[model samples]
Target: MIETINSSKQAIALEDKYGAHNYHPLPVVLSKGEGVFLWDVEGKKYYDFLSAYSAVNQGHCHPRIKNALVEQAGTLTLTSRAFHNDVLGPFEKYITEYFGFDKVLPMNTGAEGVETAIKIARKWGYEVKGVDENKATIVVAENNFHGRTSTIISFSSDENARKNFGPYTPGFIKIPYDNIKALEEALEEENVVAFLVEPIQGEAGVYTPADDYLRKVSEVCKSKNVLFIADEIQTGIARTGSLLAVCGNCTCEGHCEKQDTYTKPDMLILGKAISGGFYPVSAVLADDHIMNVIRPGQHGSTFGGNPLGAKVAMTALEVVRDEKLALNARKLGKLFRIRMQKLVDTYKILKLVRGKGLLNAVVVNDTEKGSTAWDMCIALKDNGLLAKPTHGNIIRFAPPLVMTEEQLHECCDIIEKVVREFEK
Candidate 1:
């Protein structure tokens, strides 16, 4: 084993020497985390603003989720899909019922969950929808960030993700987000099986669509006999005000089928906080009619429904409900925006504040090539908060759902101070 490093400088040097340069992370080298706070290597404390891209929504190293993972690990870890594991059945049933879906297909990561949905949609198109063989198309939004997988990145409009990533996969049509007319036009194309989209475009700088965007799109897809697939990996599980961003204004303790406010997608893709950042867990939920298309042996993963992950996911979801994270996010998100809006009014450098729930962002008055947002983020970090710029000019600020109002207020103070003090 390698010798322990004591300083942030040592850690950074090691990463530069050994790790791939794919990511440009903030300079801080974090060593510990709790509910809404993180501690760097030198013991500098700061509020966690990003939540690991919304993966740690339930909070960092949540105790209940940790206990569940440890307990399951001590008993059984991986009994793979080759055989039935006790935890998998219960977890599947629990998740299906919890999300108001007929079935759940477990996966190990958000990208894999998205990939599974695509495969399911394609198979359903060929078998049930009677689409021509090898001619099915799935329409996606222009500025979407579904995943970095070869097929998922194929339809990306962002050159940074798509450049040199091909010979790209085909059968995907791109359309502008929040455009009902564009969605309608895309549906007109023959053999269109699904419209895969994020409820709120997280990686696209927390771009929230119109209030009724999902409902209208669902109606259009329903009329066109196409599946409405919602990629809620970052925005689901109480990260948004509701359990799912597509749930709209419904903040009920659990998903309510009676409430029409919830724009239920035909397929819901969930990940990230599904295990409360304790384990890599994700799932695709669908009704039997669409899910039944995939027979046994058609698709499976070695560690998809492992007992350890299942237990962690079950407990993680329980934490979301039991701790009332959705209600907390709704309450604090309003206050957060109000506070940020004040900064927007005072600071000419800030263009606007936009987002629903804690998944929010502020647009800097700078070109994409400029470094204003990045500089402000570094300032915020130095002043005891951690956030990062998304698409250059936009910096996303998403804290854990378990954060208290008082802690949120403190973070807002740090943000305001950073903005007011930023020169460039």
Candidate 2:
């Protein structure tokens, strides 16, 4: 019989002994989660502020999504792309219509979705845009966090993620984020096929750009005849108070192409919360004109369009729409910012607070090398909330979107109490 682990210390030791040290996770051993709260092995319950990096926007173990997974699991889990599955067709139709895209190519993870978008863009460049073969180049923003794949990391400005990971893949051009002139200049190179960017720089400490940045980018890409790819893995599915971060300030429940704030991208890459943290599911969406460039065997994943994932993702999206998570995120986000701004004004330890929706960040008034942000997160853990730091000094707070206003106020109170005690 297998021995059961019953303590946080034991769980930590088990991971330390066996797991790779790639991630320096916060020392919290979670055993169960429901809605916006998690229970440690010791039965201590705490509010989950990270929401698995915005993958649980529908909250943990969401019954609707969970039921979908279970029902599909018992029926048809996967038939692979070699044969058609009943769920894949419906899912494709649902998601494409949901996002106002002509078609969608399903993939398994956010990184895979990004990789698929890159492939699609390059193919569209060669077949559609007449870019020279083997010379199609994609433009990316500096400090962008797409994924850790070799090709994705090749253009990364973070040396820590890039160090010793070369000789890196070529054909990528790096430009400053949120700068229109720089993008125009890069597009002048003639070989630039696509401009890929995050709607909001989530991993780079929730760096929300100017309101007009994406709108202007859309115009520029159209004029230059280059594909504009929005990697919304972290910011999509109502996490940024919109269906997609590229939607800007639009309050629509679904993709509204007619909305003025909607800066539609040529290619949309979505993942993370697409399955509500229940399973790994991702998608790359585009219109027929651009997506038709992909031919059979050019790209595929075995688990990409599996039936179980399809059902779960469909239900997950339904939850977001039916519950109007985007509206909630928008209202709660305003409240969160107001609460955080007050703390920023009064506390010397806080530098500033910035973000949209529930994906806010509080920058500690210390250097990037300082431990203050990490220390504060630890303090929050002890006081019944869990958050994590990014870029050393910025602590990101993205709780489940299902969080109630009363619960939000309670969490804010905990934050205030922790800050007060820490300052003393």
Clashing pairs in 2: none
In model 2, what lDDT does residue 196 have?
97
Worst 10 residues of 1 by lDDT: 415-424
How much does each candidate deviate from the true structure in C-alpha RMSD? 0.9, 0.8
For 1-424, candidate 2 gives per-residue lDDT tens digits of: 7759889899889889989989999999999999999999999999999999999999999998989898999998888899998899999999999999999999999999999999999989999999889999999999999999998889999999999999999999999999999999999997889999999999999999999999999999999999999999999999989989998899899878789999999999999999999999999999999999988998999999999999999999999999999999999999999999999999898889999999999999889999988999999999999999999999999999999999999999999998888778
Which segments of candidate 1 are over 4 A away from where they belong?
none
Against the true structure, candidate 2 reaches a TM-score of 0.99
| Candidate 2: worst-modelled 10 consecutive residues by lDDT | 1-10
For candidate 1, give the lDDT: 0.93
* Model 1, position 412: C-alpha lDDT score: 91
